[model samples]
Target: MLKILKYSFYEMIRSRWIFIYSGFYLIASMALLLLSNDISKVLISLTNIIIILTPLIGILFGTIYYYNSKEFIQLLMAQALSRWSIFTGMYLGLAAALCISILIGIGIPLIAYGVLGSAELSLFLLLITMACVLSIVFSLMAFLIALKFDDKVKGLSISIFVWLFFAIIYDGIFLLLLLGFKEYPLDKLTISMIVLNPIDLARILILMKLDMSAMMGYTGAVLSKFLGKNIGMIIISFSLLLWVILPLWTIRRVSMKKDF
Candidate 1:
């Protein structure tokens, strides 16, 4: 497993896409820093970008890497490697690679800007944590999704659709439901809906951390009333942790039963 992990990690690190991905974050972070001296505003802007882009890239890269590495996977299987090790190692390798890209891409500029000594440091760390968690959660999901389909085109299509649903459609649908039932109380429903979608969960977590939940309107009030800051943070953190575990566990199960 370790050997497989090392191979996959190094192989991905050598890829030009990883460089481009990391470079994108580095340039974006630098640009944000240059545009605004206000760390809070910059963090918010970054939160928005990371929430959307991280998962997109994570899942896309996972699916593509899965299909691209089929030949290597076959070779590993022929050598009697354990299915769990192969799948899990590959997943970790890909996820770790993405995390590194995120760290490098976002870390350098912030460090250079002396965020480490600033009061906003904790918030910056939280933002990075959420970004990396999203990367792992979505990439693991991509692997599980890819495993279900042998067709690369079909797999890629479903991957994109899954991302779209979670990142965009889910929120739109949630808003429509709220508008349709504006007269009725939706506190419980609103919380449940946000908890169900990882992207929404992440956005709420960051907004709360930013101390901007007042801008969240009724939903924010309900969250604060019901969960409070500490409890809400705990719940959100636990849920995000499950988002990582459940998918990876499913990947292991699926790989064991999969013919490939």
Candidate 2:
């Protein structure tokens, strides 16, 4: 597993996509900081970008990597290795490469700006943490899709649709529901809805950290009013953790059972 992991990690680390991904964040962060003296404002702006872009990149890169390396993957499967180890190692390697890109991409500017005060530092860490977790979760999802479908086109399409649904469509539908049923209490429902979508959960958590719950609109206020910040963070964090774990478990199952 470690060898497979090292190979995948180093291989992906050399990818031009990783460099572009890292460079985008670096340039965007620096630009935002240059434009705004307010660190919180800069973070909120980056949060919007990270929350949407990270998962998209994760899925795209994961599916492309898996498909491009299909021959090598098959070769590895013929070896004396556990399928679990092979898939898990590959997934971890891909995810680790992404997470590091995010860290370096965003971390440099935040640190240079002296965002190291207790409150600001925690917020910055939370942003990076959420970005890393999103990368892991979606990349795992992409791998699972790739493993399930033999056709690269089908796998990549489904993977992208999954990202689209979570990042955009889900919110649109949720808003329609809120509008149609604004007469009743939806605090619990709202929380459940947000928890169900990792993107929404991450956005809410970051907004809370920024002390900009008001910007979250009704959903944010309800989240704060009902659960309070700390408890809400715990629930959302656990939900995000489940997002990572469930896909991983599914990937393992599919990899073990598949004929590959």
Candidate 3:
């Protein structure tokens, strides 16, 4: 397991795309902070960009890496290594690499700009938590895509569409339902809706801390009223965890049965 992990990490570290992604994130972070007059605005903008880009990059890069490394994986499989070890190692290694890149690119800048102080601790926690969630979601998506589709284009398309659906279209559908049920108790309903979408939960978590939950309009107010308590927050956090774990477990199962 350790050997497989080390090999996977080395492969990611040496990839040109990793450097390019990190560079783009770093430049964007620096530019945002340098240009913004308000620290809060800077943080908000940075968080939004990170949330959008992190999962997309993670899924695309991870899937491509897995497909490109097919021969290497097969070579290792020819040895005595277990399939679980290989799969977990690759997943963990890729996740670690992406996490480190994000930490360096966005985390460092936020910290440097005094975004890690007590006043901003909750916000910082949200950022880190969202980053972890993004990595987990995308890593598993990549694995699933690789397992389900042999063509690189098909796998990559699946990843992008999945991201888009969850990130954008899912919210649109939720809004449509909310509009259709105008007389309902939206606060509770909004909480229930959040349970279905990790991206929405992430946005709520961060924006609530930023006191921008109101920007969500009526739904935001509803969530703020209901999810303002410690217990409410805990429940939502657990829901987010479920979002990460379920797909990952499914991916693991599929990978176990997958032929190299």
Candidate 4:
């Protein structure tokens, strides 16, 4: 596993897209810093970027890598390597490369600005945490989906649609439901809705870190009121964790049953 992990990590780190992904973050971070010399504002901006880009990048990167590495995967499978080691290693390695990109891309600017010691420290950490979580969650989802479909085009399309559902359409449906049922009690329903969508859960987490629950919308406000800050954060964090784990577990199961 470690050997496969090292190889996967090295391969992913050396990929052209990894550099592009990290470069984008670096440029964005620098631009945000120049525009607003406040670390808090920078963090909030970064959070929004992470929320949007992480899933898109992860979905694309994971599926593309899985398909592109088909030959490599088959070659490894012919060897004595366990499917578990080969696959989980690739997943972890990809996730690690993404984490590095995020850390260096955003961390450099925050450190250079010398705002690491301010009250925004916690928010900064939370932003990084959520970004990393989002990366792994969607990337693993991509890998699992790719494993399920034989055709690259089909796998890619499904992965993208899955992302769209979670990242955008899910929110739209939630809003519509709320509007359609404003006359009914929706406190618990609201919490359930946000909890079901990882992106929304992430937004709530960051909003809480920014201490701006008012921006959390109706569902978020209800969640905040019911669970309060501390408990709500714990639950949201746990939910995000499940989002990360479920895909990884699915990847393992699917890889185990499917023949290369």
Of 1 and 4, the candidate ahead on lDDT is 1
lDDT scores of the candidates, listed in order: 0.90, 0.89, 0.80, 0.86
Residue 143's C-alpha lDDT in candidate 4? 92
Give the per-residue lDDT of model 3 (tens digit) for 42-160.
77887888778877887888788889888888888888988778878888888888888888777777788887664766777678768777877777778878878988898888989
Q: Write candidate 4's Cα lDDT for 1-260 as tens digits.
A: 88887889999999999999899999999999999977888888888888999999999999999999888899999989899999988778898999999988888878788867788888888788878888888898899899999899999999999999998899899989989999999887888888878888888767865767676676557766755767766777778778877877887788888877
Give the alpha carbon lDDT tens digit for every residue of 153-193 in model 1: 99999999999999999999999999999999888789889
Ranking by TM-score: 1, 2, 4, 3
TM-score per candidate, chains pooled: 0.96, 0.95, 0.92, 0.94
So what's the TM-score on candidate 3? 0.92
Q: What is the lDDT of candidate 4?
A: 0.86
Better of 2 and 4 by lDDT: 2
Indicate the residue-level lDDT of 42 in model 3.
74
Superposed model 1: Cα runs more than 4 Å off: 227-230
Order the candidate numbers by lDDT, best to worst. Answer: 1, 2, 4, 3
